[model samples]
Target: MLGFIDSADSHLMSTRSCGACSLHSSHRHALEEIRKVPISKRQILCLIALAYGNFCVAACVSLQAPFFPAECDNKGVSSQVYGLIFGIYELVILTASPIFGKMFAYVSPNFFLESGLFLAGITTVLFGILDRIADSLQFTVLAFSLRIFEGAGAAAFLTSCYTIMPLEFPDHISFLFALLETFFGLGLIVGPTVGGALFEVGGYITPFAVLGTCMILGSLVSIILLPKSGGVTQSKSPSVFAFLCDIGTLLDVLTIAGCLNLIGFNAATLEHHLRQFNLSPTKIGSIFIITGSVYALTNPLWGKLGEYKFDARWMSILGTAINIVGLLFMGPADFLPIEPQLWLVIVSLIIVGIGMAAKQVSAYIACLNDTINRRGYPNETSTYALVSATNFSSCSAGAFLGPSVGGYLLGTIGYRASTQVILGFEILTLILLVLYKLCGS
Candidate 1:
């Protein structure tokens, strides 16, 4: 009895000696961390700036989408030039992503991010002024050139912001990432809506000018408050080239998300599908509302899950499964052997949105975890740069490819058949993911 009491006293004296207590303490610490929110004014300012920057980047990407063709027509340029202008923007972003990522070795991410914002602002101003040019060839040339520059700026901005995120909010990295994505998604939708309104109010120049001013203002705020350096020191950073050469480390799931985005966007347009139903324009628009709302609502939830060390692979698998089910149900809602209800279309899209959120959030967290845990880097700017670059490039490529390929398939093979093509691609992605999981385990 004396010996047992002595042992209990010793255990009480040294908490670490009690394995169960140690575990409970560790778990308590983790829970405390998860519950803790950012409290610093600097953190709040930085997050606001980052979120706004994401919004601006997405907005800029889509702003010209609606008005470019009309503007080209006004300048007497061929409609083909319109596509070139948009294509050039995305192409430049794709190529510059890695280049800017490499630059982080020599320069601070803040410099790249701020400079990119400035560049985007200046290019937007140039776009507004280019409308004054009366000559078609000159107008086309200058506009395309400006857009290319804007793309470079966008690449720098995106890379820097994402790289800085984990650094700034190390404790809540996944949550922050989700928030950034949410703002970006909103920006994509808002840009065109606001741009159209501005066009109606004051034509092409007005939207550009208004948005440019806002960007410049945001840049100034960032310059004042943004960190002068990236999250990790350059001295501790790995060589970008070395990282890229290690192709095994690259997140293949990102490429899948990119492909999914392509299919998802094409599905969102739903012009041909809706035509089959003979729905009114209002009804067609409501279909988009359903999908978009679900996507936006669930983004933050996925982000929180990622932050909590949720198994991204499992999340992705679940997401992909849901996506496949959605795609299968989208086929011939009216003409199928057993006529599918219109509500199935809505149900499938909601499931697809949830799946997309899971895949996107989980894939990002997986890559981030791989970099931090597997590679064991102290400062992860280069790794994050590559991650951000891969994401931007893949999504951009998918956006460009989805419409082009999906359109061709739809035109040639019809809606039901084109869906099969998309389904096949998704299935391929799922198979690869499963293999990846097996290898990882």
Candidate 2:
């Protein structure tokens, strides 16, 4: 279990321990001092900006869900092509995150945060007008290009925000992280509803145009309210490769990827599945809300558990188990001898949402703690940036893989069999996690 750290060069470990001891002492002192004071006005303003940013980015990501596939179908594009377009955003994010992570020391987080919001907002507005291109090929190309740029902007925004949070509130890292995620969850909850309603009112362009303008305005406000420093101090940071080399850390990262894969799978295919109900866009969007609502409500509980020093591995294991059960019912499996029902889908989504929140929160905390504690990485902005990049990249990878794979499978084998394939992947992840725990003992 500790083999990765144990196998490192003894000399290097001794050097790292000395450096880390001093860093940890200083870090702890700073946090203790911060706790003694009331939350500063600056911190409050920063939190508001960060929370709003999270909300906007998430809303943009999910906003397309209710209408995108049908719109693509109308344009003569196939499910496979549209799925790849969706996956491409995460692909870009995965590629861009490590590059931004390495630059954290040289650049101010405020620059990344504000610029990212602006870029994403602009691209979103551009995307709104893509329907004007009547040619199928042109529409596809523009869609892909805009999504790619938007993904890069999202990557920068997320990475910088992650780094900023730990620096600003080291004492409440997990809680604050969870709190921001709650806002993200809220964005997910709201995106489809608003998008569906706006799409009904003004067709394809309205949701993007309206939401994109809000993001642009939000960026301008963030520039004014966010602190100039971003709490970054120049320091040597460990490479992203260093974190990947550790077995424990790698496992936690894999857990994040697997969990997100399930999410991406649903995002890509669930709208199609619900077509059988012949629901309106607004109702379809409301169905999408079930999972996000559960996730938003449950995230704080998981974060509080992490803040109180609960065993994260156990939380992960339990979450995985719950997720598997949800998936089993989600498909009603080929073996269950039951037909799909609206109530069943809702129940399964609620369960999956709870499980996802638990896994996500615990995995992040586990990765961060394992790096700083067991691996002896320093508690500083550089380390925070690297960790943020690694985890977000994992999520991007899963998000990319899930839709690309799920779409192909959905087109080829249909929804029921496709869900079973996802179930198999989750089972594999569960087995690996259990084996790791048992072997470590």
Candidate 3:
């Protein structure tokens, strides 16, 4: 997987006479590189199948946010218990993703991909079944177990997808990563909308049933359509321990992950805060759509930018700065002296989305570049696996922490103050970025 880095070829921004011309030239160069890579018809089919599978996996990850709380209340579940049920999925992912990532060293990627989908499908069905059971310790335990099971599946599916892309499209790593994330973002955008609509029409069970069936179909596609294996050798793989302990790389993970935590922090509270205005569910949901749409739409653009114009570190830092401005505008809309317009919130969310897309894509590229530089090649499975796992793990940690921390602050001090938590985190990240840049210079 290790390819020689051509310094002139790798730095896309240096290729042209002017800024706009540079962007266009780099884009054309990217297209030309992609065109040079000859992917077989079967490879195309498999990539599509994997993409679809990732979509379903992402949808399942988010489907419960809208309906689960109401259902838990109806079943007499406590707020703490409900929150636990909600967070446990990510908690499981945080712990399990690394293990699954490492397993790719010994197991076939196809095996993990197919088996994970099947397990996720089964667990989704089980989660729906929990809806029928009387609320009790048994019910709560079963629910937690099912969510953990699904999380394991999610971890496996994502690890496999992330690993496959770099291996399969080694020449177009940034573009392919961006493309895959676009699908993932699309699923997240649609999941709540579709799940809520299904819940309204067919009750609590329908969304999981429909989405779970999709997973089963994805599993079949993985088994039948995708290749069985493109084996990565293990003899020269990096120690997972060493990779985790490296301070420089670990700092990158912390910086990106910490910024992501703030994004999650604001997002987790968006619907709740919007409802303070007595807005209709449809109106509130539309706000989410705007944010998600922006994230989905700009993901590929950011990917292209990282691949062409600048080093991903610069992108990540700039992304963090932009996100801070957006986050400041987001919450305590009620606290503003003027009556808050919906337009303001919408614009803020869009900005947030753009910043998130930049950070997430660039961070991944930065990590991959760092890994390649350290290892003298990009083909090291354990190195990629560890990096990928750390990415997912940190994101999951943020997802879990965001709601808990944000909700706690909201309850204790009120909405305006709750946002300060996010502000503090982002400010800290900005300072770190500046310090790192100065020190590197």
Q: Compared to the true structure, candidate 3 yields what TM-score?
A: 0.79
Error of 3 at 228 (Å): 2.8
Best by lDDT: 2
Better of 1 and 3 by lDDT: 3
List the candidates' TM-scores in order.
0.66, 0.84, 0.79
lDDT of 1 at 126: 74
lDDT of 1 by residue, 1-441 (tens): 000001111111112223334211222243344477644778888998888888887676656544554566678865345545655665676678767776787778898899898899889867888778999989988988998898888888887886787677666554455467667767666666677567767877987888877777778888988866643344444665565454334544343444345443443235456555765433543564454457667755765565565676777776777777777777643235645457877787787777766766566555545555666653333444455444445566655555445645555566676776777777877777788788864
Give lDDT tens digits, candidate 2, residues 1-441.
000111111111122224544221232233444466567888899999998988898888889888888878788877788888888988988888767866887888889989999999999989899778888999999999999999988888887887787677645553465467667767777889999999989988999999988788779988988887743555666876766997778778888887768877877788888888788899888888887677767866775665565677778888888898999888678778889887898899999989887887677667766777778877655676567557766778888988888778878887778889988877877887788778862
Please provide, for model 3 over 1-441, each residue's C-alpha lDDT reduced to its tens digit, 9 standing for 90 to 100.
Answer: 000011112332212223334322444455665777767787788788778987888777667666565566567765456555656776777787667766788788878888888999889866877778885777778887998898888777876776676566666654455456556766776777787677777878888899999988999988888876754544555666767675556656766566446545544455556655775443444565665677667765876777668787888788888887876776633345644456666877888778877777676667666766654444434455456556666677766676556655654665566776777777787777678767772
The clash numbers for all candidates, in the given order, read 0, 0, 2
Question: How would the candidate models be sorted by TM-score, starting from the highest?
Answer: 2, 3, 1
Greater-lDDT candidate between 1 and 2: 2
Q: What are the lDDT scores of the predictions, listed in order? A: 0.62, 0.76, 0.66
Displacement of the residue 155 alpha carbon in candidate 1, Å: 1.5
Off by over 4 Å in 2: 1-35, 40-43, 104-107, 164-176, 230-234, 303-311, 368-386
